[model samples]
Target: MSNALRVLMAQQNFLVGDIPGNTQKVIDGANQARMQQADVVMFPELALTGYPPEDLLLRPSLETRVGQALQRLCDEVRDIYLVVGYPRMRDGKLYNMAGVIHNGQLLGEYAKQCLPNYQVFDEKRYFSEGDQPLVVPINGVPVALTVCEDIWHPGPALQAREAGAQLMLNINASPFHIDKPRHRTELLRERARQAGCPILYVNMVGGQDELVFDGGSKVVDVAGELLFSGDHFQEADYLVEFDSASGRLSCAHPSEPHPTLEQSVYNALVLGVRDYVNKNGFKGVVLGLSGGIDSALTLAVAVDALGAERVEAVMMPFRYTSSMSLEDAEAEANTLGVQYDVISIEPMFDTFMGQLADQFEGTARDTTEENLQARCRGVLLMAISNKKGYLVLTTGNKSEMAVGYSTLYGDMAGGFDVLKDVPKTLVYRLSNYRNSISPVIPQRVIDRPPSAELAPDQTDQDSLPDYDVLDRILELYVECDYSADAIIAEGFDETDVKRVIWLVDINEYKRRQAPVGVRITQRGFGRDRRYPITSGWKAGV
Candidate 1:
């Protein structure tokens, strides 16, 4: 047996339901590892079937196809040890299993023990838990293997240590949230120190539906020291050498951290949008650039994600839109160098008001008139999407989406919403970051007051509280799941807390109809949050 062990980390993206394509990715990764003289190559959890296959696991034919794909991968990649994640049906139960393959033969398999059931994860619905931990000898070094959630608990690591394993390798398709990488590192270090073995954590990187997997995969020594860390929100294939004599593992180089939180969030959103579009077979994206903060940020993210060539931004202003807004929108469009269009909503707005004038009788011009303008823009954006085969990207933020501040099927008419999980405060931060990159968004766009521009002199503050104050209360009530009283006790005014909570509770119906967006926080307004839309409960502040 050699005194040195070389392993390759295959951090790549996989398209869900594309069996042949995913199998080819595994084969290619193995070939790359073998070229680097690596003895083993590890991939992310469920790499063969793609992460979060969701209900696709229920179909028998899908499982058969994945199994056949695995066999084909085994036959295609030779002389290199491969640890690939896939779903396996054994006996009468289904398991999230990792297969150890060498020389066209299956070495052994270990199923994931801990199945995460909370926060965008529902593995318990599709897979049964595995109790046994398996350690295999590769090049005379005992290597213990576990799936994604298994390492989160102490049981699997303890079992591996008791099995005389020298190193622990975990394959994961863990999704990303703000500060998730730091949390993962802290947990992995603790596990390594406890198990008294070097731990290698390999995570999947790419966008999967509402979830984004930032592959900051790393290795920690028995003393809980980081030996290597991979890049976040990008894909790479790299090799690490583990010294069997001293049980020390180190990568050739260290990965750099993202420049800033805004940079990290922006990159995540870009990757999320890029993979979502490509994986879903969409050629491009179309968005309504209302010359507002939300739409501006969405356009920046879209241009960065699919490239300016694949992004199309339209300015659909009504009679009430300020001239400054029109100028700012055009300047931002020109700066990003993407295709832009000016589709004035005056004709459509007049048509709608004419049709509803008789019905609206004495309801003197109020929110109904304001909403008509929004609906007109929505029709124009959707029309372009339908005609050009582009996916409409909605541009509402979480703060607005949470409180019914946005009109349903109006600005919310799109296939994807880029800022659905971002709050208004973060929107400002990301906009600033975008400008910092190259000053693509004009300074006036960032400095000017925020407004929907649905009516003359309309501003977000007119209907809602200040963004800074509102976002703080929202973070407490929504993200922290705090009660109205709890929020008020946290230094917020009682009326403000009650109003924010009430708005959140009453707006579930609108959120249900809003387009799906990237999930950057622990609780996005998607599947992670499910509330009764018809509830009559009120906050008792």
Candidate 2:
């Protein structure tokens, strides 16, 4: 074999704030790398303390735990060059840092210079900026070290090259959003080509809250050609061999193909649901299956995530519920092999109507009555969730949630929303995509028109714009950050554009209180995009 400094990149899933467990993970990775005859074992950012420790960084025991964890690594890792990330406290200051250790000796530490403070990152709040550059020699090859955000700009890569480094190793905990993989590939190429050195980027995978880090770890050559890559949506340990003598890198496995549009979004939802339920210690998940595309898609995602035994679908039908809906809901449950139950809300609805009869003596029936129907279903789902210890999964999609189409304390009542970031138009696409895999969703469910069934005969279009048009407007206004006039200029109907903007603006309060969900897009509702709940600003076309 040619003389090469073998590097092992561990793309792992780390639970935030689990110092002991995370430390064990690092030890295991180092051992695996040694067994593979690696010279360096490189880990993702914050591999020791986990990424985005958030307020856990403020814990009184935070520094103590980090020190103990580092000591454990120093004592245990003796043969391989171990590069691991952890939060550092030095001179009464905290910095995002990575340490180089070998043969039970702490060689040096590299504090992260760039602390990202946008989207899902708030590194500035906890970490003081590190200005020094760290370059360590492994097998006589100078390998420069950098954190996640450092490589995003040009300074760190150039600095590493200027420091006489042969290759750069950057550790990351970067979360996934739509189109991010491609964007990252291009950005890494630009950086490598500019620095004139190969780069190995290791990213953590797994879901944390709304953030899902798709461990698409990769290594590119000096000319920016990809030499190695890993699969998406799984925690993987890829042993990549980089030849320092001949500048040739190789892997045993070819790069796994990137997922398609629907697959990518669906995988994000699955990972998000799985981690949220499992990490929070929920027994399972319970959700209302209204026989509509939104609920059907959510049910399928839940089953794919937690398995049929852990997911329960309750069809809370009302007087207006159709026979077709009942059949479709049952068919979906049977196809998915999930625990299914029927809970009729007619009696509950009558009781609530009876209780409010005196107060509603004069007002004619309107959204109030429709909202009551939704609330009745919500109450049933919540009660079952409480008794069974299953977290409630809300099925409202982005198109509905963006507008005032959803009722407060009604359909919005749930522990987590699986489709909070998914638009209504995408719900149908995802449903079809899931069916294509195993045909779990009923064909009729995908073909039928969507309705709330809260009224005698109600279609969503009667209350709001068509989903195709609504989703487009939402993408422009919400995701693209366009003004009313800007969207109208895109050739949308003036009236539809105005109404959609108005609804999204007025519904900010409801969304602020809504449950969190998976974020597949760059500008999802939670950390990525934030608007004032109460504002006097008006959009004009």
Candidate 3:
């Protein structure tokens, strides 16, 4: 029996639906691990097809491609045990499977037992759950295998321990949310303690549409103490040595300090934008720079994600545009070293208002004029995006999005929204966090009152509650699923709570049309929350 077992955890980023590419990555990763003297290497769940492949799993060629990929790994990889995740079909049913390949032979396979069906997961729609546990031997030490959601529950790990496993390896495609890293650590520790064995977890890193997987893979001792923690929001490989004789584990590196909440969220947004733009083949990104905190923060994020050369900021000024905004916009662009342009939207606004003069013969000036100004700016930005092959990044945050405070084809005109799921309060906090690294955003930008600048002397609070109060109410009502009365019972104003809920309920149509953004919360407005646009339900209950 071997005294020491070397395991390599491959935390990698994979493109969805790229079976052949992902296969080659697996082969390369396996060979690299073998060169590093690892006896076994483990990859993330569904690394062959990427996570949440959505409807792509239903393609007829999925099984064929997976079979060929497995064959290639078996042929090309040698002198090491490869535990990889892919989809398998048997008896007219599909399973989320992890297979062990060694020296051109398939040794064993484990199908995922727990299928997650809640927020951002629909595994039950695609896979039939496995009823049995899989325990394999590597280097004379028995090891149990489980998929992402399995470790969240206690049954699978306990089953593995009862099956004579000395160690456990769990592969995952877990997506990021605020404080999820800490939650994962606590969960793993409890699971390891319960199973009475050391557990090594490998998670994938990268952004998939609205989902950003932060790769903070971890290992915990049998006593529920952490041994090693991997990097977040990037791909890396680490080796861990397990002593079979004494049941001790040693890692090449120590756990990195966990990031602050703001840092984690900022990193997630940057990764989300970077992958979404690059993966979709955009040349760069362009956004309207209103000099408000929202656009200022968005610009900083874009520059951080794609660099100054790939990002462009345009200031579309109207009659009510402030001098302070103009100065701050240019200062911000210069500070970030991005291409800056100032285009006056007076002509476009005049043209539109003239065209609509006859139809508005009896109409009084209200939000219509304001919306027209926004539409002009939107049109200008969209034109630049079309000509430059840049993705338009909208700057509205969740507060404005919730209250229907934005125009349909106006501020919402973009292919991607940088702050779609972020609340107004958090936006300020992130801006401050970004500046703490270095002062790119001017202090005045952070200090000034936020405004749309569509009308004279307008500020956001003119029509909305204080951001602190509004954000709290939103957290309760939108994320916590608190009814209007329940929120009011939480000591919020009755009028404000009812009004906020009404706006959120009626704005489902707008949110449905809004561009997808990074989902940093468990209840972000994308896949996490699915409300009908035409529902007759009220928020009173």
For 3-117, candidate 3 gives per-residue lDDT tens digits of: 7989999999999988999999998999899899999999999999988799999999999999999999989999999999999997899999988989999999999999999
Q: What is the C-alpha lDDT of each candidate?
A: 0.87, 0.89, 0.93
Q: Which tens-of-lDDT digit does each residue in 1-541 have in candidate 1? A: 4468898888888888777889998998899899899999999999988988999999979768977987897789898999999998999888999999999899999989999999899999999999998999988888999988887899999999999988888899999888888888889999998787998888999998899999988888999987778899989876888988888787876666633678778888999999988888888999988777788888999998888999998998777888888998899899899999998889878877788888988887788777777787788888888898889999989899878998877888889988989999999999898888788877788888899887778788998889999999988877888888888778888887788788899888888888888999888898798888888666663
State TM-scores per candidate: 0.98, 0.98, 0.99
How do the residues 469-529 of candidate 2 rate in per-residue lDDT, one tens digit apiece?
A: 9999999998888999999999999999999999999999999999999888878888887
N/CA/C clash count, model 1: 0
User: Which has the higher TM-score value, candidate number 2 or candidate number 3?
Assistant: 3
Ranking by TM-score: 3, 1, 2
Sorting all predicted structures by lDDT, with the top scorer first, yields 3, 2, 1
| 164: Cα error in model 2, Å | 0.6
Error at 169, model 1, angstroms: 1.1
Compare the candidates by TM-score and give the number of the best one: 3
Residue-pair clashes per prediction, in order, are 0, 0, 0
List runs of model 1 lying over 4 Å from the truth: none
- The candidate maximizing lDDT is 3
